[model samples]
Target: MKILDRYILTSFLKTFATVFVILFFIFILQGIWLFIAELAGKDLDAWLVVKFLLFYSPNIVPLVLPLSILLASIMTFGNFAENYEFAAMKSSGISLKRAMRSLTVFIFALSIVAFFFANNVIPRAHYKFINLRKNIVQRKPAMAIVQGQFNAIGNFNIKVDKKSGENGEKLEGVTIHKRLPGATNTTVIRSKTGLLRSSENDNLLQLELFDGYYYEEITTKKPAERKKVPFAKSSFSKQVMNIDLTMLNNNDMDKEQIAHTNTMLNLKELVYTIDSLESNYSKERQSITDNITNRINLTLSKPKIINPILDKKIVDTTEVANTLAERDSVPDKLLALFDTNEDKNRLLEIASNSLNSSKFVISSGQNQVREKIKSINSHWHSLYEKFVIGFACILMFFIGAPLGAIIRKGGLGLPIVFAILIFIIFHFINTFGKKLAQENGIPPFLGAWMSSFVLSPLAILLTYRATNDIGLINMDNVLLPLQKLAQKLFKAKSKEAK
Candidate 1:
């Protein structure tokens, strides 16, 4: 390799490494802050927290890598352009494309590695990360109970108006609702103050209440005999309640079941899962159609007399006229169907029942179709995400490299600003497209590649401008119109003042 190629590659790789570490660390810290409530005051071991962060790091990599590449590329090329090294190389008959040859090759190789990492390593990391988080949450059930929220603890639903103290043991204005087994009544307890403590073995929680009222509603067996349901109420100075923590234990969850989620699958597994889901959806749709068709056919095939009074061509008009005359005007033909009140009631009941049954069938079919579509959309989105991440690395490099060269700025000042702005736009487009696809507004493939389609043209334009030694943007062209408009506005304001 030439000295210039080695120099550029080495500089780029170093910048990439530094930028990646900084960005990853920043994101990890942000994640910690977001989950501080869940992790802090849990009495968790230091190693466990570190392990959780380590497992979570892979999820952040896909986000960090692209941004790191953008920043690194910008800084690397921006340095060259600012130092006039690019001019020197250009004078020596080396084109911008030629100068980018080594870095381009390196980026391609990195992209391939990124693809494998995303497909193989990241999926396992996601599985482990999710399960570990669940286990941590289980281990610290008290942490799961947020202040000012209703929390379900076994058969009891507990809420607190305020929770304080170092371990969040002190509670004020507490309400507990306990469901009775095999009974319709609930036991409600309200406390002015309470203390929460865990057992030595951590298998149970003890709640001690102060100045509370206990109320229970009792239902009598003979509702017909009682004028009102009876209830029992009692005031207490202090009371202790025991809550079982077995359900919240980590052992309750099966690792295999949690690991089977779409986020935990590689490309091959995702494809297989998608295929299975689509197959099941197709079968369900076919079954639903067949059932609906059969039901409609059965309803159609039932022999029905088009003329209900076929046996009597000339109905007894005198009786019908008398019946209709009692109401108001006499309609002999319509009054013939209501020969008796019982007959009219039965006909109305049958019609109502048939209408309800038809509504139920239609509603059930629609719900099934919607659920199937959502499941299929999710699978397809996951499948496309695997390829998109790798491609994003290469795409971002093209954008950053040309942008840096055109702007002719280095360091964390201008380059960082430009990188962040462009990255934000890219991320927004990608997220918006995914949401649209998830809602079935667009095709999954198109949604997944939407960001690429939008940014590819910008990358090409930037590269072209950079190769021709054009400025990043024409400021004069933008400012001239705005200046003229402002002057006109100022003149109009002055005229109004005069």
Candidate 2:
């Protein structure tokens, strides 16, 4: 290897390693901050905490690696340009492309490594990380209930406005919803103040309440009876309830029960899962369509009449049409359909209920379709993200190296500023595109590659300008337009004054 090539490679490697380690640590700290609600005051073992962070660290690599490469490339090449090394090379006839040859090869190799890491290592890590978090919640059930949020514990959903005391055992304004089996209504229990207590020997958490109320809406199998809105209510000065905590002590921490998440799947798994999901989604949609078709295109058959003289039933062909056309609409029209006003009212009531039920079914089906579309989009996004990481390395390097050469600035001053601004733009576009894709606003392919498509031209433009030894921005070209505009405005003001 030539001395110049070796020197450039070593310079970039040193800067890259430094920047990567620093950024990796910084991002890890941010992760800790994000999950502090689950981690803080949980009394987790030190080693368990370390393991959680270790499993989480791999997911941060995709975010850090590209930024590091961009910053490192800019710093290295900017220093070369600023320190006259590039000038010397140019004097001896070494062109910009020739200087970039070795670095480009290195980046290409790095991109491949990044692809494999994202495909294999990150998925496994994500699987483990999510399992670890779930197990933590199971082992320490108290930690699952963060302040001011509804949390499911045992058979009820519990929420508290405030939790005080050293161990957060004293609660104020506590509310609980206990749902009955196979029922839609919930029994509500509310308290002004509550106390939580437990012991190591017992597998139950006892909740003691003061100044509470118990309210439950009575439901019945008959819809007519249920419309009366019957309810049961009572007041209590104090009450004690025992919530079982045996499930929290389960020893299945190593079990991979949450493997169906999108992040846990690789290319092959994603393909299989997406196919299965689409098949199921298609069947569900067809079922809904058929139901709607049946409801909308319903036809009433002719009524049968009894003939006392012949002692046989006779079909009244005009019965349906005559009944329908008797009145303008609804209850009045049902007069010919039923002999009594009471029976006619009943028929009208049934029709109203059926129409309402159909409306509910259609609304529910629409929501289900939207949710499935989002799930499919998420899977596709995950599938493409693995490849995007690798391409990003090449993309960032091209932009950074050329930009550094064109600007002729080194160190952590202007280079750092440029790297940060460029990276922010890249990251923002990536997030926006992904969000749009997840919501089905755009195709997943376009959304996943949006940032790359937007920035790739900048890389090419920078490389071209640097190769031809053009300034970062031609000041004369920019200033000429502004100068002419200012002069024209000044002339206009002078004419107005005259």
lDDT for each residue of candidate 2 in 1-498, tens digit (9 for 90 to 100): 899899999999999999999999999999999988778867788988998899999999999999999999999999999999999999999999999999999999999999999989999999999988888776766656667988888888889999998888899999999986688777999999999887655788889999999999887888888998778999999999888889776647677778568999888999999999899899989888888868878434442433334536554657645654654365645468789889988988998998999999899999998999999999999999999999999999999999999888888999899999999999999999999999999999989999999999999999999999986798999999999999999999999999
Clashing pairs in 2: none
Provide the RMSD of all predictions against the true structure, rounded to 1 decimal: 7.8, 7.0
Superposition TM-score, candidate 2 onto the true structure: 0.84
Note the Cα lDDT for every prediction shown.
0.85, 0.89
What's model 1's lDDT at 81?
93
Error of 1 at 47 (Å): 0.5
Whole-model lDDT, model 1? 0.85
The reply for model 1, stretches above 4 Å from the true place, is: 152-157, 172-194, 200-202, 208-240, 246-259, 290-336, 339-357, 473-498
Clashing pairs in 1: none
Which digits, one per residue and each the tens of the lDDT, describe model 1 over residues 318-421?
Answer: 75566556756646555365889888888889878978887799889989888888878877888888888889999999999998898889999999999999
